[model samples]
Target: MDPTGTVAIRARLAQAAAVIVTITMLAGTADLALTDVFVGGEGGHAVYRIPSIIRTTSGRLLAFAEARGSQSDNGSNDVVVRSSDDAGTTWGAMRTVCDEPGRSLNNPCAVNLTSGPHAGRILLMFQSYPTGKGEGSVATGFDGPYTCRTLVMHSDDRGETWSTPRDVSRQVKRPAPVTSVATGPGIGIQLVSGSHAGRVVMPFNEGPAGKWRVYAAYSDDGGDEWKLGEPAPEDNAGHGNEVQMAERADGSLLLVARQFGGGGRRKSAVSTDGGASWSTLQAVPDLVDPSCMGGLIATSSVGAPCLVCTGPASAKDRTNGQAWISTDGGATWPRALPIYPGSFAYSVPVVLSDSRVGILFERDSTSKISFITLELPSNAAPAAKTP
Candidate 1:
């Protein structure tokens, strides 16, 4: 009648516009696969950066960083480590917990003593720093021995093999005028609670780069000996550097420095008695970071005693890497959880036994070294089998 019914009505409007554009082009989308566990030139090093993940009471999942042979964070660094008994997916090769070849041990901090008599061995501090022309020019010397020192090593069948460096740096490096003293680009905590239960803390920082600040170094007979506390007080936002710690439930202690020239976010403090003294600096602008380096622990059981933290929530750079929990401990972090979006600077969470929460970062451009695994935000806190 009308030319075959108008050609079957334009072929049913061209198959209803191709099924409405393939159902809105397949709708929702998501794909984020990461696993670069440190690969900037690989195996032999070239540039690794600072990251520090831990979780060994026998459970295993120790990871560290700062391999660098030349990417310039200072120079010829070392302090590599690896191990993952099936947590971060896979990782086992890279060792070198601290190579002092020409000097530049880097900043790798570890801790897993657990209880009293060194509950399970594994305490790796670092900071050899000093290359070529005496690098930071400590006081005015070259050779070796001291010039920004702070070494300490040990591993009892967990980190595999390590135990050579042990220069208390005169207890824990005092006499500040600043030149170097970095133990812990991340990872270190043992105090169980109150009265400094068991103690083993570690979270340090000195100066010579931008006038950094932040101090802490405990032991109480566990890691043998490791004094040095009191220095993290002045933090309106001007100095303080790459620090991180967590020991609270009642014991007292909570550091989280990394504020550079006094920008704004990320400064935290509070040591009731554990870290000796620390109370001034408090900014935590919601865990932002252009100032980089973050990773504070203390997750207790599963809820209440919370205080996570991973970096690059971004205030200016490193992109958006998240996972900032905190439940009234650091005062407020509310519940973030982004983990990798662009570059993601330094990070280190570790609280997994089963509760889940491993975040070992420094990805996007620092060559490699990445990890993720979180689950905390069902209202923001509640679950305590052990964190």
Candidate 2:
């Protein structure tokens, strides 16, 4: 059906239901219509940075970022968060999630653990730096005296209150003085079929080369006693800066990575034996990323596992960001649609259960963040053209 016809049918249906219920259905519809459409950063602060967004099982949209302080050196950055109960229509006032005494926190990644022991918990992973220090110069890749630690903060009752930050870095035996390039607990996923089934898997980067690695730590009896898994193969020298893993329909796991080295292209590797043994690094054709972090989601929609990744379309820059879809696992991807034309840094795209796409990315070079929601075109086909 045509777009106009679809809109008219939906409106008529809503109105008819309102009349049947004898309530102000039309008014509610009008209010929804008046809700500010998702225009990216239309109503957000002008100077937000390092934005991360996630959707809850109840459909609440939560966005978190580092609200930069004044230029005159005001101590540290503030970790702020906002929520949208009605999809992406409107957002509540920004609230400080973490205000450290003498430290700065940034690069927030959140996940709603729907399975395992902590089923309804919301886990937030971010990096914390010591007092009076900015995230180390990118040239050094966070190798400095400031000391950055990976922390996990969780909320059991939604966003109302959070448990004290739990240091997961202890799981990894760090060298004396702890100066060997440990920066992030960036993104986490739940393992489905591995020996460490139901364990929380977090992908982090270390060393000047930024060799990205995946660490598995499971809390068998809730978040009380946690065990760490051995390092998986195929992560040597590859900067797993922003790692994403998804369990395929066949119970296998597919891990996607963005290379931080030169060329800025996306790479993929498969773990048939549940992340223990992985295939060699192979380039994912048609997906280009400029060493920037992107988001990936695996869903069982078309009778098979479908994957979606949002990253740069340009070969050498992160200015042109696009969304690519894969149908036959991660073997190949073909469909590419532009999400933003100009330079947007490290946008994370999330797929909701209803198939809608939510992306939060940096607007310009000025540390501003924008949020956008798109209803993916149903007629769009996967680039692989298989499943």
Candidate 3:
């Protein structure tokens, strides 16, 4: 659609009094409605950061973030979430899904099982650390007060209630020498095709903070038993950290990651064996990175295979939040649209029921976690097959 047509859609929605806060309309993109789902210093938390969003099987939108007691990364933090039944038009009360008295429960990565006995269950995985220990101070072991541990929880009732967290550090994290692990800080993906169909793949990063390496922790029996996968081949471009994954229509997986202190360009890899191994990493020429995590989602809108990415468009700062559309199965991003003009970081995107895309992101220097939805222009043809 044209720019004028996009504006008309916004005008009609406003006339009908939709329960949304219309932010701004960019050229050639549909109404970009904004909703502040989590506010800083509210609900007894000092700040909110690291937004991860997903739509459940029951069609409920669950937005998750770390509710920190202080602005520091090592401050007392809890994994909290809020749900919206109307596609983010309105949100329910905030609830804490994981917490500890003197520990930090961070990185809320979630995925929904679609088959087997535990089908429809939502699995949430996060990392736990001592209250005063950040990535640099965390030890390189599988068990200790200073070591990082991976935990998993589930909610069978769609964000209303959750089960007790189960420790899976042994299954997911490697021992001594690989420390300071993070589970996505974004959402996970489930394969819909290929020999390993219905597999759950969650992006992960390990090793010291600056020397970080990316891998995948996966489950085959609908999240029944978790196991670690081989790490991606090291690239001379940069060290990978805080990653996200999306499966292509041809069944291969594409992993995008934030480069830890390299040039301002995102790194990517491909996996043909269902996340067990990956090809050598390469720098994404189009995505401008600021050493911050970004969001990614794959969709087949109108039968065209495409990928939507959300991140800071500027190479120097975390400002100028924007969304880029990749119709060629993530080979390149030729189209871009603005999401926020300033102070945006750590975002995740989900495909709404109406074929529109919803991005939940942190803005205003971690004071607010907001959401926005936009319609993708349907112009590209279906993706060609790859071997």
Candidate 1 residue lDDT tens string, 69-162:
7878657688888888877666777877777776777778888887898689888887776664232566422234557777788888888888
Query: How far is 266's C-alpha from truth in model 3 (Å)?
Result: 0.4
lDDT pick, better of 1 and 2: 1
Off by over 4 Å in 3: 1-29, 379-387
Q: Compared to the true structure, candidate 2 yields what TM-score?
A: 0.74
- Model 1 CA deviation exceeding 4 Å by range: 1-32, 39-43, 46-64, 68-101, 108-126, 129-145, 149-173, 176-180, 187-294, 297-307, 310-324, 331-358, 361-368, 373-381
lDDT for each residue of candidate 2 in 1-387, tens digit (9 for 90 to 100): 111211111222232121111111111211112121122333343346666677776778777766555421124656677887866656776777887777767667676776777887888876666656543332232334456665678888767678888766555324342232332223456666556566555444444334444333435443545454444454344445556666665666666666766345666667665544456665565567677767777764334468777766666666755677778777767654445555766666666556567677664453456655544544453332110
> Please, what is the whole-model Cα lDDT of each candidate in the order they appear?
0.71, 0.56, 0.82
| Sliding window of 10 residues with minimal summed lDDT for model 3 | 1-10
- Give the Cα error of residue 37 in candidate 1, in Å: 4.0
Candidate 3: clashing residue pairs, number: 0
Sort by TM-score, top down from the best: 3, 2, 1
Pitting candidate 1 against candidate 3, the one with the higher TM-score is 3
All predictions: root-mean-square deviation over Cα?
A: 20.9, 8.3, 4.6
In candidate 2, stretches whose alpha carbon ends up further than 4 angstroms from where it belongs are: 1-46, 70-75, 132-146, 172-186, 191-197, 209-238, 272-279, 301-304, 381-387
TM-score of 1: 0.32
What local lDDT score does residue 31 receive in model 1, on the 0 to 100 scale?
28
Of candidate 2, the 10-residue stretch with the lowest lDDT total is 18-27
